[model samples]
Target: MIEVEHLSKRYGSAPAIKDVTFSVEKGEILGFLGPNGAGKTTTMRILTGYLPATSGTARIAGFDVHEDSMAVRKHIGYLPETPPLYPDMTVEGFLHFVARIKGVAAGDRANRVQSAIQRCNLQERRQTLIRKLSKGFRQRVGIAQAIVHDPPAIILDEPTVGLDPRQIIEVRNLIKSLAGEHTIILSTHILPEVSMTCNRVAIINRGEVVATNTPEELLQQLTEGTGYELEVEGNIVNLTTYLQRLAGVRGVEQLSNQYLPEHRHKLRISLEPGQDLGRNIAAIVVKSGLGLYEMRRVQASLEDVFLELTTEEKPIDAEKTIHTEPAVDSASPASDSVVEAAQTTPTTSPTLVPESTHPSGGEDA
Candidate 1:
């Protein structure tokens, strides 16, 4: 359970994120998405207590992140974009070290470490040094450490940044498995990750939350209605003129060249929302003596929603299922300063974060 209200952060006069707001229910995995310099990292930093917000409030498991920093840290497991790892330490050794630092009790450390290893599929590699492991294994090691102390909420930023396809799927499945037991806020630029892994999505652009809704709802909301793509042969001019006159047909655009005799001509027919123009279009093409090669509906996708929102100068009409959160200022011009700074700056090394809730770090393995 997490809630952020009217969150804003400013680097000097330039705003990194402004009036951003969203919530995640218990057992829900929320995907935080945005383009480069869209205040994603800034927002995450504020939530983690690594950086403070200029204004607004963030609470984790009912504890205020700003007012009760230490208590809030106790309930959250954080993995920055770069995982904090000691290269020389063995897998089991590193997890044991992290468990202790995260305040796992001495008696419970062994079980906690073992569970993390098993959950992250690090059982066989437990004896391998982190330096010797591949990037994928190293990422698994990073995730293992986050859950080692068994925190209720986990914050993972770019958990699968550079892994191969197989490894990506493995890590995706692993994150999915943690859903019911943990409340996760996954921040990544990868759209597929959000579509496949998250329960809901929050699309932030220019330091503001432009859209917040389920992936399905966002897709339908932002979709430019529906239409059909057709591959037809023979007299294209007559077919185009005929289809354009059909009821419910909004427009028609030719997608392929008609000059080539060997290839069939491709035409995209646009239709109003909720219109089924396939049956009527087919009859017209056949009646006019043109051979219809192929026809299929063009469904809306998440990538469509993402590009439209991020690229637009003004926020999309709020009436769409995906409305911009009212708290954020929608009229302000998007700031590119944050994006430029992130690109020019070098990334810092990762650190193993230890919470202060427990009496002390666990004993050494």
Candidate 2:
């Protein structure tokens, strides 16, 4: 429901975002990821009409963000990095004011305000002044305001920042629930947020989009530093040396030697991406007379793609070298679904290859 083409923004001689482009599908939660100074907030501001782009076209639900500014604003709800809240206003009063400003019908204003308050779990604090609420509660109030009008799309910048773990989970669940009803462009640096909450992700770096795809598809793009972890019961002191010498094996690092019985050891095995080393490693362990208690294939994650994309010094062209992986065998679930995105050992860090445009757009510094 969003589109951006060749979007760019500059301040003085330096560019904040250059040729930034990306799109978000209807009813999708797209994580807009980038490091500091990578222009994420700049892009969001432009799309929300708070800032203008130097040059480019941005459309929201077919409405031109620039030419149809009012129309676009009507269809979108935006929460800036720092929530704009009236500390003196009570929660109910604030939401009622927001509903009016967002143009909710007079007859429906009460319902909309109540729905927002309920959805954000602000019932207990609806009578409390915003200034009296904790940071987490205030954040919920900000989100409640954004959705009070029930817009078609929502642009959230760091929705979970400053929240405690419990608060973060509450907000995360709330965001997930909003999908299908409201298209969301979630801009944040928290990798796990993208992995757990978003259907797809866009990584921007050096004022440009470097990658865009589903989290799983992007993880498959890693060409190195993919492998497994093993817990074995053995006494071999030279296992690391042997594993390293094996074909396709990149490196072996012993993580721990602790065991009550003193026969078990845990080690991490690094391999080239897409390498089928599981059977070989298992066989080697058997031949070495070690009991393989567990072996779980490591999977790449959004963080891996983010670090690879943003850490690079050069700009990446999203049009080329970014494609989804073909059908491949899925890794067996031997461990938690949480991907350990540790840097690949003994291999060059993987490079991010972007494919589609994510409509992050652009804005001035």
Query: How close is every model to the real structure, measured as TM-score?
Result: 0.82, 0.77
Q: Report the number of the highest-TM-score candidate.
A: 1
Instruction: Report the lDDT tens digits of candidate 2 across residue range 266-318.
Output: 77777765566666667666655678888887766666677777775544432
Number of clashes recorded per candidate: 1, 6
lDDT of 2: 0.79
Whole-model lDDT per candidate: 0.79, 0.79
**Which ten contiguous residues of candidate 2 have the minimum total lDDT?**
334-343
Q: Which pairs clash in the backbone of model 2?
A: 22-357, 22-358, 22-359, 23-357, 23-358, 23-359
Candidate 1 — what's its lDDT? 0.79
lDDT of 1 by residue, 80-124 (tens): 777899999999999999989888999999999999999999989
